[model samples]
Target: SKTVSTILVTGGSSGIGKCIAIECYRQGAFITLVARNEEKLLQAKKEVEKCAINDKQVVLCISVDVSSDYSQVESVIKQAQEKLGPVDMLVNCAGTSMSGKFEEVEVDRFKKLMEVNYLGSVYPTRAVITTMKERRMGRIMFVSSQAGQIGLFGYTAYSPSKFALRGLAESLQMEIKPYNIYVTVAYPPDTDTPGLAEENKTKPLETRLISETSGVCQPEQVAKIVVRDAIVTMGLFRTIALFYLGSFDSIVRRCMIQREQSKAADKRE
Candidate 1:
């Protein structure tokens, strides 16, 4: 069966989410935007409408907290599928952060970060996986971070959540390969988004230093490249040029060493 014209994006109300939603709309893909804030979702819908070349449909904003649970995510997905038809693609962008030394960060904050960043993708993937599997076709992309690719100081809470997502994508890719469900994990350089700017102000100096050193790519630039990659990739880590994979491996090793040293010092103190 030819896929439907719609794509679903979580966290689509703002930042890179909003940018990608707009880009997809401009490319004539009908979009279903999922986010927690109704007002922000409406604003995103307006932006998508402005960019849309086809008046076929502007965009459908489904206010949803994708992290809550399977039932909640499934309910939203059902509504979107009913209204927009089968979702041809899903971009899991809903995420949150809890930055502080691990000891300074509260347990609740850590759990909240994990719920929103990791389980946010899990719940929605659970909702859509069966259908995509049955159809044997779909595209799923994750807006992971350089933190996931290479941990910086004080991402104690945030890094683990994104790292879990990378692992999830790796596992799911293998499982879905035979079904032709492509999965791409994107590692965007720090992007100048409203959320990112807010994070910059509060981030620990060490974390800020790393971000300052690594050029902050614009949201539009990351969005366009990610969309293009999503369209072109086959499945899993395969289509990602091997050099990046090798580079990612090296970074992960270095990060692990740094984390070990930090943990040891904390234990001694």
Candidate 2:
């Protein structure tokens, strides 16, 4: 019977972020959607406005790269707060993914992921944490990926950035718990989103094969269950991961053999 009064979501222009906004909007929360693209933000605002349950509900859109400048992120967040009232919930969903063999991935790509995935979450959290502490209550959510849990083939550049979110969540929880603020870190599986489709285009054969073994989930499906993933499943989850690691190893071996054979054939010509 309780409802969050104001919800601010970065990367809410698309993917799981937008869906989360819609779900919360249905509960009558005032919504603010932040992303880098102005067109997409407006489009997302229209889609989210459809789920409004009360005439009082409002959807605001702000376009700014969450990872670019801390001051800029803080400024936009302040503007959003001024318009929508203090943010009751801050969702850090703005992140990017790139995949390739460790040695093949451009060195710059690793730094880019850290900026988008780690600092993107940090800037917004930094901007709002102070106010949340002053108010003595709020919820902060980080949307990480399954890759965050176990490093996999071709995720050499992407996994660590996602993994960093868990560390941030764990440390932030301890500091904020005393103020009655809670942090939630969601490790969602391969989701069917534009981001995933783009990532697939560049994924290594090994990564793609491993991904097929664990299909994909729709955004709405993910948005529904991640809220409950707070349950302690680490013990069993790690055991299962080891089994998958064995399968992943075989997949990588198979791809290596195929690539070597193709290279040898080219030499004969």
Candidate 3:
């Protein structure tokens, strides 16, 4: 197994982020939780600490709005590094979603979703990437949704932001592959999270129906799959599928490749 000693998780105060933090802590990593809510960050820190292997294991929390300012995100990451040493892994779990028809959702809401979902991941990755490059070793994971791979009804504002993350992950993988850093994107289905609960409140009927086709998953389960994929050294465009819909893209791609191969063989014959 890969040894990841220090981990920084954005949105670590709740949902998938909190679960990832606790799971990494259980695996003996020094955990740093960053989010906007001070109360929740403190609570997450306490929960993660309980999973620490020994008293020396550290669990720290920093309250900051990841989408508000890039410099602030960079500074907080630096502080965490000073306390826990260089981060071996950075999980971009800080994101939000809005569900409604394209026209019904305000233009500002689309922008807000982009800022929180896309730039939120970008800022922190920008902060630590250089150090990881200097060391020529690290792991990065982006928590994109199943909707990212396949567009879904009511996710017009949300899906595009997630799709942007896949683009970022693919491009970053190309640039960072030579540095020995691993990048993985995870597509989890509708998960039972506080964020999801809030999203459901505004979710359109059609959107809810589309999402219900794929059963929900627990945050803990998704976290395990994400962490496991992050540790493995892999090529660019690697995706972790946590549910049926999450694997749809990969399945379609595989079929296309198989068809092409068959055609090539027939031509040779």
Candidate 3: tens digits of C-alpha lDDT, residues 195-252: 9999999899998888889989999999988888787547344343336533554565
Q: Best candidate, lDDT-wise?
A: 3
Clashing pairs in 2: none
RMSD of 1: 12.3
Number of clashing residue pairs in every model?
Answer: 0, 0, 0
N/CA/C clash count, model 1? 0
The CA lDDT of each predicted structure is 0.83, 0.85, 0.87
CA RMSD of each candidate after superposition: 12.3, 17.2, 9.9
Q: TM-score of model 2 relative to the true fold?
A: 0.83
Candidate 2 residues lying further than 4 Å off, grouped into runs, are 1-4, 227-269
Q: Would you list the clashing residue pairs of candidate 3? A: none
**Residue-level lDDT tens digits of model 1 in 170-201:** 86776676567889888887888888877776
| CA shift of 182, model 2, Å | 0.5
Error of 1 at 36 (Å): 0.9
10 residues in a row with least lDDT, candidate 1: 233-242
lDDT of 3 at 250: 58
